[model samples]
Target: MAVSNQEQTPVEAEERGARARTARLMLDTAVQLMQGGIVPSVSDVAEAAGVSRATAYRYFPSQAALVQAVVDEALGPILDWKSASVEATERVGDLLSSSLPRIDAFEATFRAALKLSLDQWAQRQAGTQGSEPQFTRGHRIDLLRDAVAPLRGRIPEAGLDRLGKALSLLFGIEALIVIKDIWGGSAEEAREVVLWAANALMAAAEAEADKS
Candidate 1:
């Protein structure tokens, strides 16, 4: 019997969906092992993901490759910030503040990314840069400025500088360690710190503007 075009499309779509699910499951297992300090092996991950060693190996050829892909997928939300235009710089802070909730939501993923980045850096023979994408810090700063731009008159130079520093430091490795590893705060707490800091800066900016 000949398959109709309509039936073929659904079959193709199902295949795509199944592949996506399998890929995601593999990624999730890798992340879980990473989080647990297990240094996930292919066999371990395969078992966790409920797939055969052959299937797991087919999907991820090596530990580094699997780690790279999982970390990339995990950081997708933050790295893909939608910058409408260069004019976005003016309101970077606001846009960044809006992402505070999202930041909290993905704290585990973020924590795992920090570890992966460090591992990559260590492999660079101690002086070279890490394997992680460079956009993390730069993008965060860019978005911060964009969110704060509309309140420029309200935000003093010192205040803006402080805000930038906070975003770079608190929102990066430092905060990842402090909140996730040391303090053991939930994702919500991590995000709240960022949001509160941003809002405080905005409030201070507003106060300064009022004095003018």
Candidate 2:
């Protein structure tokens, strides 16, 4: 019998649903393990998810692939975040106020991703990293640009770029770790620190634009 090309048979539909469930299980397991602050291999996630190595490997081809899925999970709402306020400073503040908490909540997972990226960097430097997919970072750049987007006409392009760079240092897990672990501040304090600095940078950029 010639099967319809567009429609899945009952068996095919069941297999697709089963595959999706298995992928979700492995990804959930990966996120749970990453919460403890270490990036787990595909095999590790498979074991923890009660899945066999072959099945896990079939779902996720490598450690990088697993981490990528978990990173997307960790990023979730933060990636789609946008500010309703029209004010540049207010937008920046809104972005920080909303995102910092999420970053802190997923601090362990972000740190794990950072560590893996650093490892890949070191391996590449030593000419030892072979055939491994590099873990990607730098979501902050676009987010910052979007946050300060209201200043495009008011500030020079370079000033806006500089502001984004300065803000990046005070954002994300790096900033959270500094404010929480090093400065020993509370989450509220971390938010305060980022807001103050972000506001100050916004002011400085506008001030520079005035001079321009």
lDDT against the true structure, per candidate, is: 0.63, 0.87
Candidate 2: tens digits of C-alpha lDDT, residues 103-195? 888889999998999899999999998998888888888988999898887877877888899999988888877887899998788888888
Off by over 4 Å in 1: 1-17, 34-43, 72-80, 83-90, 126-166, 179-212
lDDT for residue 135 in candidate 2, whole number 0-100: 80
Q: Candidate 2: where are CA atoms >4 Å away?
A: 1-6
Among all candidates shown, the one with the greatest lDDT: 2
Score candidate 2 by lDDT. 0.87
Error of 1 at 192 (Å): 6.8
lDDT of 1 by residue, 92-117 (tens): 54455555555555556555656655
Name the Cα RMSD for model 2.
1.9
Candidate 1: clashing residue pairs, number: 14
Full-model lDDT, candidate 1 = 0.63
